[model samples]
Target: MGTWNEGAFDNDDASDFIDDLAEAPDWRTVIQMLDHVTKSAGYLEAPEGQMAVAAAAIVAAAVGDVAILPDDRRDLKAALGAPPQGAVALARSALARVVAPASELDELWQEGDDHDAWLTQIAALQTTLSASQ
Candidate 1:
């Protein structure tokens, strides 16, 4: 099983660190990590609340980079636009939903079964997303 950054989803300090990374213009590492988390979330099975929670966790880590800004920040928008299609887009969308400041990741996590379906979905999404790139 892949190890998750449990602290990132459960604590403020870890979230702050992730937030700082997301804010950096050169966020390659952050992006890659988010990508990984996206794949992980996709694997979550339906009715499995943790899927959303995992997605939310990943999104929270990179929301600063993906969030839409006012017209003044066109450059930021262009740089962080959604992925074209397939798993990449799906992953991006899932992450976007989770990190949306108003989202409740803990709630989602608390609502689902711990099945391997999520892992499968994430693996497929990861393969498709990576191949597309």
Candidate 2:
């Protein structure tokens, strides 16, 4: 995980995921990424958690939570339009998984001095996602 900060798209995997979405902006891609994280049976890798965060951010943006998104990605709100209710639900689940036990992303961050900051960012995203529900 080439993470530089706590923002959703501030890492290599997340940036790559967003780039893929930009190429063919589809809601299914967002939901699929979220599902990948939520359905993982074992420890969730850092890269998967990163991408799931990015996907959840997109779902939040799609439902008018653009303020929770990075500036460059705010346009995705228009590109993605509105996500289905299921995607919104999945986004919340995916985010919970990203911060749950066995999540490499969470484990790694917990070892850092900025873990609280990262958790705050996730919480903000979750709050934004919840508002859309």
Candidate 3:
């Protein structure tokens, strides 16, 4: 929950997740992260939400939507080339869950002054992901 700004990767959990992706960059890693949110049964924690957002962003970037991506994370695109089959759909699903009810990430942002901005960021990521579908 150590979020600094509203951008998808502008948080501690997301930064850590990216570092982990750098080690074993692969498509499944992104899917697995997204599944943590899309397949969740109960409340989604902020860290998981953050990681999922980062994962979705990677998928978006892989499919040629790099507008929302940070410069440092862009290199990951080469390490993990084209997104896996159905990745765009999975990313879209995960993003919907991230901003939905019981999502700690969403709830936390709603409590902050920049909630609208945070939401706009997520929406942009979703829009980018959807475009590739």
Q: What is candidate 2's CA lDDT for residue 57? A: 85
1-133: candidate 1 lDDT, tens digit per residue: 1214332223343344344434763434334544554445343332222343333333322233333222333353345344323434545455444443333443343344632443443344344434445
Task: Mark the regions of model 1 whose C-alpha exceeds 4 Å error after superposition.
Answer: 1-15, 22-24, 41-133
Candidate 2's error at 56, in angstroms? 0.4
Report the C-alpha lDDT of model 2 over 29-76, residue by residue, as the tens digit: 888888888999899999999999999888877775577667776787
Best by lDDT: 2
Q: How far in Å is the alpha carbon of 118 misplaced in model 2?
A: 0.4
TM-score of each: 0.28, 0.94, 0.95
List the candidate 3 regions with Cα displacement exceeding 4 Å: none
- What TM-score does structure 2 among the candidates reach? 0.94
Q: Residue 115 in model 1: shift from native, Å?
A: 21
Write down the RMSD of all candidates, one decimal each: 11.5, 1.1, 1.1
Q: Report the candidate with higher lDDT, 1 versus 2.
A: 2
Please give the RMSD of candidate 3 to the true structure: 1.1
